[model samples]
Target chain A: MLRVENLSAWYGEARVLRDVALRVDAGEVVTLVGRNGAGKTTVLRCLMGLHAGQRGTVELDGRDIGRLPTHRRARLGLGWVPDDRGSYASLSVAEQLTLPPVLRPRSSAERTGLAWSLERVFEAFPVLYQRRSVPASTLSGGEQQMLALARVLRMGARLLLCDEPTEGLSPLLVTQVGDILRQAKRHGVTVLLVEQNLRFATEVADRHYLLAQGAVAEALDNSAVRSRERELLAYLGI
Target chain B: MTGFLQNTFNGLVSGAFYALLALGLAVIFGMLRVVNFAHGAFYMLGAFGAYVLLAEAGVSFWWALLLMPIGLALFGMLLERAVVHRLGRLDPLYNFLFTFGLTLILQDVVKSRYGVQSSPYATPAELSGSVDLGLFDFPTYRVFILVFAVAVCALVWWLLSHTRVGVVVRAATERPELTRAFGIDVGRWVTPVFGFGVGLAGLAGVLAAPMRAVNPLMGADLIIVVFAVVVIGGLGSIFGSVAAGFGIGLVQSWGEAYAPPIVAQTLVFIVMAAVLLLRPAGLFGREESAA
Candidate 1:
């Protein structure tokens, strides 16, 4: 389980994340939906400790991790998939997959199953296997996205903080990602996703935190989000 | 023609030093984004280490070669932890300036100890004579230096390409912050990498002791050329720096043979300027990763 309480963030003088609070229980997928500049990324950044200009309490499985550095947060099973599929141009696809050293899960509760082996990861994404020997930058956008997500999964990250993983991806690729996330959730991985596509959000996430101007505007379950989809889209200017 | 061949051999020998030095520079720069102005000082230290070992402790060239690099590597790691890493969050330029200041201090320390005079080191008895190349006879020691440097470079290259640690280090070099987010303790590797880079410089310095004058100012003049080689190769590209090192060596040799003294002196800078104009990111460099 992951929890954030009163997480206020700032980019210098300008505040980004207002006193925001949210939580994702184990094996659940939650989404934070917002318009452009609504601090969706900022919220993820703060959770990952990439943004230090903030005051917040981030707890992972009852242990306060707010003071940890990014790598320490990562050791606590915090995996980040930034909006841009972060891939090293110099590293091959296989190299990228194996770059992050597999660390033991910090909390016993967070450890659910075996981390994905190279063989398993290769089996999960056959296209990646086909192009494993090639540089990661040469992979198409969708392929790179798969690499990013698959890397964290292989690291056995208990909680994934994904920022707009579906953005700029083809619909087919988006569907593939949804399947991957569902598969991850089945294996006891919890996710805190930031997505703009509410329809896709409803399909994958059990609950949605509608983030507007850096604060949680509404906490809606799947049915509520579906009922208010049209109004929400218009207000989000999407 | 014999003179030409000998000069070519000399050029390649000089290039081996540059390649060794620049390889360290590129690795350090790639990982830390700091331009290590003290690289030459370490090179001088390598030579002086060999010289002093023989002079004070009666340690031989071979032993110095093995020990100097390792000793300096440990020293480098200590310095990084004790001083360099303290300013990690500041601008990268702070490290650059700090390294430059370090270089001056190192040079002065050596100068104070030995005075500005050149120190002599006897060539190893095994490598005292010349070996017959097809064109001309070359010094046995020069041949050993060439072969040794190339073998070391190849070993380093293979280690980087094939090892898991190498992949992680390479990935970290390419993307430091993102690598951390992927659950990598990139900081854990930084000190060792920095130390390894310094070791390479020290290794190059040990190689230089026999070939060049063992004076405090030896690295002062040579480092400028090595920097040019790095610039031509591309700032952070490891392979680029090595290629540029050897390439500049050959170019300078030919320039010295065929052209005037001033042209030979300016050849590397001219090539660097041309490379900068043609490929600003360097021959091997790509534009910033869109992360």
Candidate 2:
């Protein structure tokens, strides 16, 4: 449901994304796999129009979203979870959940079809419910990640762009996140995840694109990813 | 007992001004994240607008009160669009410096035009006389100022707490990106919100026109005290700003009444320093950086 072609981005005279191209069909989970600083996160940011200086064609269901601001893109149903979590320190877990509900598109069906409510999000991560009124800063890394996911889920977002969802979490929590991703797939949410973890990427990602030196070094479908493991490792230097 | 009542009444009256000015500052700072050095200038503009309406247009005090904020808000929008909006993505210090410079220019312009002398703003004919309090007599103008100030505060509180527009503004103040992501064109809101803040400042200035001196430097000294109020209120906390503004105003009034006049002006600063030393976040302020 999303197409990005010839997408190039830069950060202050340094070219980060060079002629990168990717696509995701409805209900598919796509992964951008790369080591630290492979321009994977930049791809998600550019797609969301978060990058101030981006040039390319980003189409969501055949509409040009390249020139739209981040908010405009969000209103158009693009949900972004940055690598930093982007949590407002002053907002409580509940406040953060309630925040973006006001920014959704003007469709009644969209609002009613929300499978992720405060209760549902809490069910997904019981710890979040326990600390619903607690401020974001006091939450642990795993809890913050859960809050981030819960927040996006609360947005009723059709497309999800998650950056390093498992970077700093414990292995146990990472597994829990993997389970959440599996659950998201069941709900028909398109996910574009940026990950350095091969096991984590393979666990949920339906298709994988290995990025190296600002270009896509390898594109492996879910089945091809397993057989081409050697090629992926060489590019990743894992 | 009479003296105590008089002091309390006096404190409340002054507190009203503090509350109104601080409220505007809080709103502006909350949305813009820039310390508005020109807030007092807007306040001064309101006084001038009131004077102009009364002297030139022969308008009543009530009409000037209503029209001045709207006018100043529009002017504030122009300033925000032309100046403050450009400062976005730059160091916040640039906006602060720019506002500080604007204040000097505005004050100088007003001074050149109007002269550095207090102008008389007559109390409205309807509320011109005093009502007898049980123990002492209070002027009708003072009562009007106090009651209208409270009403304005309540109106502001209602506008901020109850409205959908307020929700968007407050949400933007807390997290601009998230608010934007949620489909709020924060850029569109910035100009109006900034203008509204300046309008509030002008409203406060109009209110003060009858009560205090209306001159070029009228807002100058008060601006410093208002900054102290902002600091004591903790940057951009709305209710904190209101409470601190009034609380400090009362404290200053009490200090001026009981203590030596020489040290009375210093009392507000003392309270601010104490609040900073003890509860650095101000009374109602949240720890924004941590979140």
Candidate 3:
């Protein structure tokens, strides 16, 4: 469960996010669908306490996380996967997977029940296991995405904030990402995803928030999003 | 053949000191992204620390060797916390300039206190005698310096490559944001890492005390040469700094034997310029992309 209210962010005098409000329930996959510059990434950064000039309260499990540092937020069970994948070029795949120390345990039984392990991650993405010793930079785009997802999972993150996890991924890799999201849902790891891909978003997310000009324009259930696909597609200009 | 061997041996002895100094520079530069212009000053402080412990406290050279680095490390940590920490958010050039100012202040203080003349440190009784190798006899202290430097370098290399702390340090060095996201407080490590780097510089100074004249300006002259070695080896490269330090030392030694004095003095700079021209990143250095 995460709640963000009246969140505003700036990049050196230029306001990017203006009074944005959103919420995600426990064990649910919620997506913020927007075109470029809709402030989706900015919202995630604000929630992570990474945006240097940010305003408004971000609550994780009813605790105010807005004032916390990025590392503190992470330690409180917030995991972020940036659009860039943020892989260390010099670190091996295994090192990247193992480096993130797990934060404090979540109180939710569903989250605590799942057996999150390196072996499980390897089973999910066998290609990573094969190239475990190889440097992260040497991996292909799809592999890097997989590595990014696997990394947050390794952190035992209760709430995962993923930005464009499927961007630049192949159709097969996109499908795999969909399957991973499904798996995450089954494990009760709540995901707040920022996506441009409507089809992928619809396939994975239980609810969708359409963002326009730095604010949430509409919030739609999965079925409503499917029925109103044409209008949403036109709005997204995809 | 004997003369050549003798020069090579001397070159290696000097190279050990250069390697030790450059290794510390590499670690500080790599982690903090600060050039640490005061590294040589820290080295000078290390030698002085040994001198103070010996002269005032009547501590033995052996004890000073162990105690000086720890004391200097604490001092370095304080300096980093009080001064360097403030400069982290500013341009790295600020830290460089700050350290340059520190070097000047430290050198001046030492000069005023100790006077401009070099002070001598006696060799430890155990390491005073010369050993006769087949080609020539060598001072026991020089041999100790060579062996001790190599051992220290190996330990540092192992610590960087093999340990968990080292892995975290290396990871943080490459990607601070991602490391933070992983719940690591990378900021906490900065102070200790800086102290450790300066401690290595101090250790080198302790090693140099018996061999070189312990003077305020001693580091000023050597720091330039060390910088040249770091440039040729590649900035922020651990192995590169070590290799280049030794390589440059050897080159300088051979030049002294084979070439004229002025040419010998200028040789390291020429090699540095060549490396910069051929590969701006240095041999082991990665090209830093604009952040």
Candidate 4:
């Protein structure tokens, strides 16, 4: 479970996320839907401690993690797949997967470990196994996305914060990503997604929040996406 | 035939120094992305470290060889954490500026401590004698330098290529953020890697101490030549550094033996200019950067 309250993040002088509040119970798949420049990515970044001017209380499992450095947060089971994929072009897929310092779970932390292996990820996306030896820069857009996800998962992430997961992929690949998200949810990994695609969000997310400017404009369960259609449409300007 | 053989032997010995110095530069450059103006100073200190260990610590040549590099490496780690880490976010030029100032400070400190007069660094009793190889005799020290330098290069190449921690370091060197996302603390690695790279420079200094004059100005004199070697090889390529180091060493050595002694130093610069003109990125520089 995670709790972020009264979070205001900034990049230089411009405020991106102002007084943003959100919460997710354990294993919840929450999609943040808004148009371009909706402060969703800023929220995720602020939580990860990448944004220095972020005034926030980002509590993970009831403990404050706002001030920890990015790597320490990662060890605490936060996986981030940035919008650019942040691919290390020189490294191979296999090298990326098995490379980092693996965090051994403590006695209480053992409950947080999800059972997913490299082979399982390869099975989920066979393209990864097929191009396992290929350098990441050579990967297609969709394959790179898969690699980005697989790499974070390999790092033993409990909460997956994906920024624009479906941004540049084909519809088929988008569906594949949706399947991957569904599978991630089934395995009890919480997902906080920033998405522009309403259809993809509706397909994968159980809970949805609409962000406008820098605040959480609306919070809707999956059913309200259809039920509260006018409110969602008005906010999205669709 | 004897003259040719002697020149060839001399070339290899000089190449060993090139390889040793360039190897240190490449490792630090790859990891830190800092041009390290102070590296030459570190290399100088390595020689000084050996000199002091022998003269002041009452240590023997062999023992100084073992301890000096490690001592310089620790010194390098402290420098990284205290000064270099503070300038991480600034333009890399700031780092160069900072290091340049540090270099001046180091050079002055050493000069004040031990006067500019070149201190003698004698070869140990065991390695002082020359060995006969059928046709002619070769100094034991020069042969040892060639063998040891190549062995160190091989060890470094193997460490970077095969080890798990090395793989992590290599990956992080290329992409720091992605490495961080993988739970690898680059903050922890950067200091030590910087230290190790400085340690290599120190080791090279210790290696050179017996071969050259040990003085404060030694670093300033040799660093420019090492930079030439790095440029001729390509900026950050380890393999290129190795090949260019040895190649330039041979060319310069041969030039000194056959050509005018006054132009021997200039010959290395001339080769560097030619490499820049022909390839621009040196032989092994990354193609993307060349364009």
**Highest lDDT against the true fold, candidate:** 1
lDDT of 4 by residue, A59-112 (tens): 999999888888888888888898887666667888877775555564585764
- Judging by DockQ, tell me the better candidate of 1 and 2: 1
Q: Write the per-residue lDDT of candidate 3 for residues A19-66, one digit (tens) a residue.
A: 999999999999999989999998988887778899997998899989
Per-residue lDDT of candidate 2, residues A1-238 (tens digit): 9998988888989999888888899899989998778898788878877777778899999888898888878877777787888776656777677767534444776556543776788877889888988778799888888888888887778888999999889999999989988888898778999988887888898898888877887788877877777877776777
List pairs with backbone clashes in candidate 1.
none
Per-model DockQ against the true two-chain complex: 0.78, 0.45, 0.73, 0.52
Interface RMSD of 3: 1.0
Quality of candidate 4's docking, in CAPRI categories? medium
User: Between candidates 2 and 3, which one is better according to TM-score?
Assistant: 3
As a TM-score, model 4 comes out at: 0.86
Best by TM-score: 1
| Per-residue C-alpha lDDT of model 1 across residues A1-238, encoded as one tens digit per residue | 8888999999889998889999899889999998999999999888888887999888998999899888888887888898888888999998888877686755587554436888989999999999999998889999999999998999888888899999999999999999999999998889999999999999999999989898999899999989998999998898
The residue-by-residue lDDT of candidate 3 on B1-291, one tens digit each, is 889888888998989988988998888887888888998999999898888889889998899899888988899899999999999889888998999999999999999999989888999999999989888998999999989999999998898777778878888888777688788898998989999989988998998898899999889889999998888888888899999988988999999999999899899998998899999999778887665
Over 4 Å off, model 1: A103-114, B1-4
* TM-score ranking from best candidate downward: 1, 3, 4, 2
Candidate 3 at residue A238, lDDT?
Answer: 85
Tell me the spans in candidate 3 whose CA falls farther than 4 Å from its real position: A108-115, A228-231, A234-237, B132-134
For model 4, what is the alpha-carbon lDDT of residue A101?
A: 51
